[model samples]
Target: MILVQYMTKSSITELTSNNKKNKVVIHLSSSTKLGHYRASCLILFAFSCVSSDCFGELMEDLTVLSPKAIAMANAVTADPPGIDSIHFNPAGLMQFEGDTLELKLATFDLKNRYSTGPQQVDPTVKASYENLTQSPYPQDPYANQQGATSEPVLLIPGGSTETVPFPIVPLGGAATRNAQHQMVFASAVYSPMMVGFSRPDDDLGRYQGNETAISRITYFSPSFGFQVGDSLALGLGINFSYQGLALRMENRAPQASAAILGGLLSGVSGQQIGPGPYDDVATLNIAAEDYLSVGFNLGLLWSPLPWFTLGLAYRSAAKSNLEGDFSMRYSHSMQELSTELRPIFPKMEGVEFERGEVKMEFTTPQHMSLGTSIMVTTKFKLNVDVQKSFYSEWDKFTFDFDQPLDYLVFASLLDSDGQDESLTLQRNYKNALSWSIAAGYQWDKSLLLRAGYQRRNSNIPGNALDLIIPISDADFYGVGFAYSTSEDSHIDLGLGYLVSRYNIDYGQSNNANSDAPLDLIYNPYAYLPIRASTRAFLLSVSYRKPF
Candidate 1:
């Protein structure tokens, strides 16, 4: 009824009331058609969802953890920061002597939006539905709408998963010279991704997902940097990380197959008897975490002359098996429909209240970068970096359920590539190449001015883009500065902004189709062209002190 009200834009008055059964019928104006279009493809997310495949790769660390890194657009490969060198280029640690400690704090403010584009439906698909249904409306059922979400959430596996204030991540590391070995040892803590967002239960965008957050925290990173030669250095780091994911989405299937079947049957039965394409059948909430995950990084730095230097680094790939719990709450209408269809599809056992343990297979691919830094003059320096992430390493993701979910079994029957206990979804992601350029100038003996820009490429192909993690090619612009408090101690502050926007044509994304003969997932806006965007503002502060 709410969907009807939103689409029809009519004031609904009481048509009839049955006090005995506590029932009320909505009266629609004569001009309003009872057409409620819902070609929605509701997806489950963790990178995928509880009962479907949807999420793709998430945002990387970028330069958020480093004030100078962000200020310099992550072009610091050739001129790594003090102790933060453990991440950018371990070899840079050799530049530090004696004891050094660094602390960093960063906050992120993000915005996401989705809006419907001009309607353009397939002639055959539209014609097929109109011909089969007895009470047919020629107009498109799914109308144009705009959606927004502001509430962000954080999930603690096996713990309280609550809504929190915007995230303020703290990252730091310490290192001391090992003169005897001519090597430097250090460790740090960081996260690859930790952001979440939510929408009101009745928000227009609830069909895609209600709340979602994916976290990859590196709790421990042990690193070593060795001075191999007078002008060369080598480094390696081993990282122990934790991965967690949380998602809550309202499920709906507005596929042609389901809608066609319902349309044909409704005509025969003289009424709408089962779930339609746009009906919100259920809500699924998933929380999973992996306590210990491992990966490694390597770095090389060379400086034959004080005027120029080159640096290279690689962060190894890793796999995680996040385990947790999931619950699916079915609507009363869906429950009754399942009961009526039980004779045929017995697995539709009315999953009004379903809970179980679940696990998923996820992979984080390796990353490689090459950078150079040059001192253009006594007071000016420039840094440039080229980076790549092997997202192509991702192909398929498997979701394992502790029990054979009856709902999954039924949902799988709609698609051939699905399984009862373990559901595998195809994910053909491509590698992304990005580059950055940054420059710094000494304003005076006590201050250094910095500015940088980076071009970030999208890993997901246009055909696979969806709202779960709708990251796209983006532009990152930043500015910051460093102030010398003492001869060897400095403070760094940076402010950065990034934006990624995409316009997905109708029927372009795989996540858009469920009725398509070959599809693995479903979304609510399948039939509508979608405009999605992400904008983020970052502020970072760092203090480096010699002990």
Candidate 2:
């Protein structure tokens, strides 16, 4: 009813009439067809839900801990320290004394949690009903028990059992033993040992059981800084980062659902399936890229009463365009299952696409931070900082796809709602916000300890309608130490951890035809409860020298 009402009121004819009568046309422009507009909207809507993917590959594995190393030790800044500051808080350069060069190497260890159950089972149910209506003995006890109905039925001979093994289906009559149900055969290889089924060659099958693995990401950062005035300094840092990812996934037994068994097909396969999810290997490569950006900082040294100083900084967002290669590959056994059935390979193109030298940019948000420190004694001092990111400026992203898929398949999956409906504009739906507070204390000049916390808002929407982006809100906690090696040299080290979580929600609409082959209109009416969490650990070490 809602779809019908919206279509009628906003129909092209209706829109044309409104345009002729009114001088100001509001909604969508008349120049573009509602279909294309809706398609673009759907694409953009999907992008907004996962804009985080737009950042360069390294960011997928990195997070900022404190704005600057000294500030990190003093717990005076919201963001993390290191060359990352050139991107997050350039104003941190203000504390530099004379001229200095710094170099750093860091690594990130990440733990991810993702899991999902069935989504939208209506189609399977409807297909079952259709099969029952075509049973051979429609009114027979067997047919009634299978169909749970006493209606007349029509039967048709299915595929050649040996030539194309159709699954032994309860629909249209008992499916021949050799019935070729490729979908079912594929499932058998996946969840080999679910309930009654057992896959003896589980290790060789594509759909192996549950699997887990870890990934290590590394970064190289170097910076040069010099003082301009009594209290101001400027610096430029070049950040180069790379990622090495290893993944293992367990496959579920393929889908051999039947109108007769209601998922009872497992009993017939008796294929010695393993006692768990199957296992498969995956490798993802992220190339190194250099980010060229600069930072500026200012400090005010004062002795109003001999014991206090104040600091202020405005960190501009590092304007950078990062370009790198992102590639992924996987090995599985599902393709082999087809050999036993049709002696042919099923062509699946989109599900396994990889990217190369994808150009992406990370435009850090403009930040404003204020800090104040007071000496309580000759050896003890405390510093505090508050900061905010103009995350709203983190706007839409542009991409140049090295490979484009078939238009029909892409359209069918992304823009199936027909026309006149969309959740977000394609290019402008992804923007986020961020903020943080920090404080640190110095017990003695030689032994300094630091700790800080931060929070970020998610740019993803609740509609859960994205294709390539992934967004999540995150929180961070950190601790660090600094040691004075000599008069002109110092070493600083920090450890930090961050937690991220978000949901992926979507829904299917009725009122669209059920019998039509392409009636599955995924409207994303609501955000489903999709919760994925990641625990990340950071280790950073840096050496600073005065020149």
The residue-by-residue lDDT of candidate 2 on 94-197, one tens digit each, is 34443455555444444444333233324443333333333221111111111011111111112001111121211000001112211100000000000101
Candidate 1 overall Cα lDDT vs. reference?
Answer: 0.69
What's the TM for model 2? 0.48
Number of the top lDDT candidate: 1
In model 1, the Cα lDDT at residue 509 comes to 79
* TM values, all candidates: 0.86, 0.48
RMSD of 1: 8.7
Give lDDT per model, in order: 0.69, 0.33
Q: Could you tell me the lDDT of residue 327 within candidate 2?
A: 46
> Tens digits of per-residue lDDT for model 1 on 368-400?
999999999999999999989888887777778
Runs in model 1 deviating more than 4 A are 1-58, 137-142, 156-159, 263-269, 411-417, 513-520
